[model samples]
Target: MTLFVVSIILSAAMLHAVWNAIVKTAADRTTMLGLVALGHVIPGAAMVVLLPLPAPESMPYVLASTLIHFGYFYMLGRAYAHGDLSVVYPIARGIVPALVALWAMIFAGEVLPLQAWGGIALIALGIQLSSWQALRSGVESGVGRAALGYAVGTGFCISAYSLTDGLGVRLSGNTLSYWAWGAFLHLFVAGFIGLRKRNTLAALRPRTWIIGIGGGLVSMTAYGLVLYAKNFAPLGAVSALRETSVIFAALIGFVFLKEGNWIRRLGAAVLMAGGVALIGTSL
Candidate 1:
């Protein structure tokens, strides 16, 4: 990938980490998630009015992505409830690069080089390293295992939606339009969750609403940048690079959430940085 594309993806990765941190720190994860989805819908509505519709061919992928994202939000909320940001975020995002690669190869017929595969492996390994302590200590317990399960499921959802939107944006002709429609479709997700958590929503303070919706806006921008980059780069490469958010999450967890050992996280960050270098050069 070009430096420009790489930079774009990295910016998105940072933003992604920020939003996930918001959710992880929130008092009510489910309600926060609903507001985040509502965040997408608010701007998406205006964008849909300003931008033209995506191609009909890509609409199916858009719908598929929306469904997958619902599963993603649910799994993410559950994962955070059970584990720390450093641990759950790594497990959730670490697997996406490899899974997206496999999906891209199988469905999109896009084969990556051996070096790229090496980079992906390093990234995945580094992610595990970030949570090595938690995994070792917590895996034997039921809650730990549950967190792991939910995190892995979140990874699957991410991979599914990444590939879907990657291909969808390519076919849409206008990346902004495709993204607007995709974001708009999250209205359903927000509505469903809102209805289920009506009392919670009603009870939330103004500060919580501001934070939740702001997080949603950040999430929307992060994914939009990724979708735009996909039009110019390989899906697997973009996915791998975007997942650098895991490293950012580790730092955020250590510094802000008071989770995990900083020494281990620093080592993991080095490994992930190396992985990014390899992927960037290979592409």
Candidate 2:
């Protein structure tokens, strides 16, 4: 990958970790989700208008992306209910690049040299090893136990969106438009579901608004950067690099949240670095 693309991926990784940390602290799911939607909705709407509309051929991919993202939001909510940012985010974000590699090979017809496969394995293994800490720590915190199942599910959902969005943007010939539309439609689904219930709409706290808007902006920026980086670099490389958000999330959890153990954090860091090294060897 080019230096520019790597830099973009790293920037996106940082933003992605930061916003996810914000989300994990949210107390009200409905309001938080809605406010997050609002944040994306503004940027998404603006981007949609700024860019040319997608070709009709790309609409199917866009719709599929929207559905997949709904699942992403739903599963994210469920995972947050069970775990901390350190545990759940790493597990969820860590799983997708490997799966995306397989998906790309089979469905997208993207090829990886043998070294790439080995690198992917290290990425997967690092994610798995990091998760062991969560399994043990979660029991005591009671925060991460339920997140195990939900976080796993969220991983699949994220892969769906990642691959689908990658394909859609590549096909549409407009990555910006594809991502903006996906973001808007995604927020639409989350917003509708949140508003459907009884009193969920009545209560909206200031923190929710602040965090949600900030998260939405950061999240949208991160996705935009990812889409751009994917276009310029190999999909697997982009995905693998992006998953380093787990490392960032772990650090944020430790420094800001002060809930993480040093040993587990170190392990997570080493595994993530190993994954990056393995990925670099392939290149």
Evaluated at residue 158, the lDDT of candidate 1 is 92
lDDT values for all models: 0.89, 0.76
In lDDT terms, how accurate is model 1? 0.89
Model 1 CA deviation exceeding 4 Å by range: 77-87, 144-146
* lDDT per residue as tens, model 1, 1-283: 8889889999999999999889878877778889999999999999999998889999999999988988887898788778765567678888999999999999999999999999988888888898888766665554557788898999999999999999999999899999999989999989999999999888889999999999999999999999999998889989998988887877888888888799999999899888888998997
Question: Candidate 2's C-alpha lDDT?
Answer: 0.76
- The positional error of residue 237 in candidate 2, measured at the CA in angstroms, is 2.4
Pairs in steric clash, model 1 = 1-283
Candidate 2 weakest lDDT stretch, 10 residues: 197-206
Across 19-128, the per-residue lDDT of candidate 2 in tens digits comes to 87777677765566576677888888888888898776877999998888778878887887777655676678778888788788888888888776676667666655
- TM-score for each of the candidates: 0.94, 0.87
* Clashing pairs in model 2, backbone N/Cα/C closer than 3 A: 82-143
